[model samples]
Target: MKFLKVGRVAIITRGRYAGKKCELGEGLKTNSETEVLTEELQVVIIQPQDNGNKSHPYPHALVAGIERYPSQITRRMSKAKQTKRSKVKPFIKVINYNHLMPTRYTLELEGLKSVITAETFKEVSQREEAKKTIKKTLEERYTSGKNRWFFTPLRF
Candidate 1:
């Protein structure tokens, strides 16, 4: 189980907002009461402080509708797993196929490409895409004799 540190909670009481997908901004404040269209409203459970108790009453109706889930308990169980991980030896090894062993020379080769293509190469922030490029480049270099593949260890 994974515990998410809740930053804020939202409880929407009426209209289309009366659904689980209501927008919740992070903070605690009494939002001004808008004129209710009707006394009957569909309450959407928006946000929870560790999953709010439905029995608890608040100005926000959304909080009152949130059914308690077993997630909080499940999250506690996973704590042991997380701690045990740091202590136990990792059976699965992370092999960087891009490098024989990511030593100084391999790292230097990667850095040199970044420096050379300082104009055309954009510094991409997405990690998955970056990794994909690196993996593709490695595969290409492993299969083909190409200088471009050599310089950019991360380029697909």
Candidate 2:
């Protein structure tokens, strides 16, 4: 009923938006200066949609949160591949948050490996008590880590 595992970030190579997938190689709290060319993105598991419905179609992945990446980072990553860089840059570091929802972005996962299985995602949202425990645990985890940031719940 509790979630101990942390989320990971990756780039969206192919989707409806194709090359415009949010850049997640960097963690969720990357700064504009460190954002060579990417957006502030997070990955989380969500319910899968049924095939029969059309209107108000259910989302296969629920968007928890979303924010734009630093402009510099977005520009660099979106640049056309003309020359190979000397070295492949490592994933950027962003502040980690606990008990906080991840940013929601529209990403088609038709062919990509999701961070967590659908079953896992549903189970987490099903129980209120479990959700609270998981959030607290995650908050502890985030605080111990460096440059981690937790979100205060929104009033809306």
Candidate 3:
């Protein structure tokens, strides 16, 4: 199986980070059954930065200047019963690869000065703009008036 490389830009399609983009970090090896069972298959790390949105809760906020998420976690069988526990502190969020959307964008971590060049910035900006326009058009077309309802209203 092909593994995700570091520096890849992926969107969190599941947990708290859902709809947010992040850069991949280092890979981790599993040495025990618990690790395999928890489906802590891979680690994805992200560093918080200023998003310029005041309402954003995680604006440049992180527990240790970084966050790590495992590739997957099994569902709970019982709401009150805790199944797996971690000795290491839990991350700010967690998600699986099934919920991650790999993007065409890739982050360059070669050096601080060369991290984001003008060309790369322009490409990213254009992609984001296109996404916004598509989302706006779709919402306007499909979410207007009575289309929001999944079923017809019942007449008493």
Which candidate should be chosen as best, given lDDT against the real structure?
Answer: 3
Angstrom error of the Cα, residue 15, model 1: value is 51
Residue pairs clashing, model 3? 71-96
How well is each residue in 41-111 modelled by candidate 2, as lDDT tens digits?
34332222222124323222221222221212233553433112111111112222221233333323221
* lDDT on C-alpha atoms for all candidate structures: 0.23, 0.26, 0.31
TM-score, per-candidate, Cα-based: 0.18, 0.25, 0.30
Worst 10 residues of 3 by lDDT: 29-38
Could you give candidate 1's per-residue lDDT for residues 64-114 as a string of tens digits?
111211111234557766434222110001111111111111111132122
- Cα distance off (Å), candidate 3, residue 48: 19
lDDT of 3 by residue, 30-146 (tens): 111112111211122333223312332222211100122212223654433322211112222223345455556554433222222222224557434533442333234333422
What TM-score does candidate 3 reach?
Answer: 0.30
Query: Which has the better lDDT: candidate 1, or candidate 2?
Result: 2
Instruction: Please report how far candidate 2 places residue 151 from its true position, in Å.
Output: 4.0
Report clash pairs, candidate 1.
133-154, 134-154
Runs in model 1 deviating more than 4 A are 1-125, 145-156
Descending-TM-score candidate ranking: 3, 2, 1
Q: State each model's C-alpha RMSD to the native.
A: 24.2, 17.2, 18.6
RMSD of 2: 17.2
